[model samples]
Target: MKKFLTLLLAVLMIASMASCAGGEGGKFELGLVTDLGTIDDKSFNQGAWEGLVQYATEKNVSHKYYQPTEQSDDAYLTGIDLAVKGGAKVIVTPGYLFEVPIFIAQDKYPDVNFILIDGEPHNADYSTYSTSANAVGILYAEDQAGFLAGYAAVKDGYRSLGFVGGMAVPAVVRYGYGFIQGAEYAGGELGLAAGDLDIKYHYTGGFAATPEAQALAASWYNDGTEVIFACGGAVGNSVMAAAEQAGAKVIGVDVDQSSESATVITSAMKGLKASVYSVITDYYAGSFPGGRTLVFEAKNNGVGLPMDSSQFRSFSQSDYDAVYAKLAGGEIPRMTELDEKGSPSVVPVEISTVTEVA
Candidate 1:
């Protein structure tokens, strides 16, 4: 009888320990839901996934992430439900596309803490919606990063540049506007002049590579645009194709593209990996910024430019040092000024009669 009692106690102890490790009660279980893109796209999805992975490994916590096979409300909701049902205490939803689904999910699962990157829920009146106390929104100053890239391009003697954006979202628009402002700044500060240098902008309306992005880039290349900033997910990959064929330089977004595309000149980096990692780490540390909106900017090392690699052998080391210093020192405000409605506009730098190019 004593042996039976001892064996039963040992089994209970083991079960209790396993439950704690799996976050069965109060421990943390993190889960991430990727947008339509795969986790390996080496862009937004990849960065967010890396953060989650790093946090999980460091904390020795249970975590998982699911990539959507399609772009639909159902797809996002299904992934969220899966995570919630899987014992997730915290859920990270990457991309602006998840805004609506996350809003609804936050209501459905009030107990699940959510991190919504790149967007926030809004009411019918367009005001920020008050989600459950468990949801936090994350955004970045994309315009500042684009501005740095544009300034660097002009400083490198590439006055004519093209911007190819994915979707008409606020993030993409900020990036485009920031690029224009930077080019204008360089033109005024360095005397490139309005007509002497050209800037073109196009919206692909999607994040993946499509014929539209390639065709638009081809047109820009034919018109003598010296560099292109591709600000879409896989759509940016199309810029590489155009650059490889036209022998023009291109800037990447989210992640460094120089390694993937030998024609890539540089990249406008958002430090997505770091942002996601920090949020998760905070949650583990009981300091998660829940129910608040987090904005990452140059001031926070949230956005900036990447180094020139083999693809950009044209850039001198001095060039990198100069731009990096200016940006880090806050001597250069890479972010674009915007109206209250989040419309992209040139603030602080006033350029009269600035027109879009064909």
Candidate 2:
């Protein structure tokens, strides 16, 4: 009888441990909802997940990620529901695509905390904007990152440059504008006439790596565009393919894309991993800055070029450091204000040749 009682007690203890491991009674603390991509996208999704995984692994907490079934409001909402149902206390949503879904989720999951990266919560039609006490919005200074790419490309002796953007969205526009500004600044430093350095700029209207984008980029390379800055998500892949064929260089975007293609010289990166990590740390420390929107910029080490793998012969790390300091110290003007048409008002170079390819 004594042996049977001891065995029964061991079984009960094992069952309790299993219940906790199964996420019963809210055992999971961290959750991530991927935005329109897989966790290994090597872009936005990967960057954010690296942060979440790093934090959770360090703290030895329970965490999981949910990928939406499709790219729609209902699909993303269902993902959030699943994450919350799995006992997630804090959720992180990556990308601007999650804006509307998160807007709804803030109220639906009132008890759960949310960290929305790259955008704020907004209505479907953008008629209303709100960030509840349970949510925090995060944005990055894409212009600064773009500026570094342009500067590095020009300094590396690339006279003719091209920019292939995904769309004329605010983030893409800022990158384009800053790239042009940096090219003009470098042209002045090199004493090159404005006409001597030409820039071909176009928006691809979508983010997919379509053959159309590849053909467009190939045509630009054939027309003597030395290096093209691919500023979109998968659009960079298209540009890289064309660059490889044309024996030309390419500038990557969003993350360190040097590993993606040999044609890529460097990438303009945002502090996605760092920013997400900081937010998670804050949430755990009970200092989550909820009910507010946060912007990451050069002043906060938020934007720059990846120099470790950059193939620049003339642009040394010290040169980059000097320029970064100027930008960070506010010596160089930031392109923050936009015009009525949502374009940067001040472009130092003549962009009369910029064509919007359909």
Candidate 3:
């Protein structure tokens, strides 16, 4: 504990000195602290950063980002502390992993405002979840986005599907469950029985690219799974690599990942860039919804598929519009973490099985 505290103190002190310098232009008033990935991972971190950059560049506000040295609660907290010390007025944290750290930081730096995307603040034990007056939590309707992906796949004639998630966090779970729901919905449209569609599900335990994840994806492809929804940050890269090797297709997550690889047929996209830009705008306009958790879903145009960039042969723009209308208009009921019993029962048990690959 002593050694850890000493290291933390050193980090904070260095950050303080940097803040004091203020560079030639001035201190960076806007800050972003990344989770376990770089800003250009073409997923979570990048999406959020793009929004910040767009807003900051237009407003001529100084902005910077700090990456943690490790992937633990302490390491994450350290990153926040550094941002605060470095004169960050408003800090944006882009994933659920920030829940605990932002929980602690909200109290530690009461004057600094925070925009927490994809999660709300909560203690480690989760017995308490509270966003202070200085912080605002932003959540996306991932289920809706995932639903679009699954519905499109089945409508376009793919029966065998696989879902590879980075972790079983609430966001990822919502995505997986929505995908299953969509597949079932489409299967019914095609007059197929409950046992007609097949889906394989698993979580990679973390949001990084790994040999194990790639190998597992390759194995699933080899076993006849038609397309895999790579829903875990850099883990998607691993799945995409596997798809390239096996000549299979992929459904990406978080943002428009179609550009990342030709194997990516589409992406279940949340408005990461637009939402961040909007929140920052609100902050500057004195209307930031502090101390509250905000939900961005289809009703508000917060989530959908990138139709213009999606490579679908039969799932035309008209097909997308029909399904998306149902989702956005509440005609389609969404299944989230709350709707699960033990786990999201990939509905119609006879047609589906969740393997939870090791």
lDDT for predicted candidate 3 compared with the true structure: 0.88
Q: List pairs with backbone clashes in candidate 3.
A: none
lDDT of each: 0.77, 0.87, 0.88
Using Cα atoms with residue i matched to residue i, what is each candidate's TM-score against the true structure?
0.82, 0.89, 0.88
Residue 250, candidate 3: Cα error in Å is: 0.8
Q: Candidate 2 lDDT, tens digit per residue, 188-217?
A: 778886487778888888889999999999
Model 2 TM-score, 2 decimals: 0.89
**Candidate No. with top TM-score:** 2
- On TM-score, the stronger of 1 and 2 is 2
| Shift in Å, residue 132, candidate 2 | 1.5
Off by over 4 Å in 1: 1-28, 123-128, 308-358
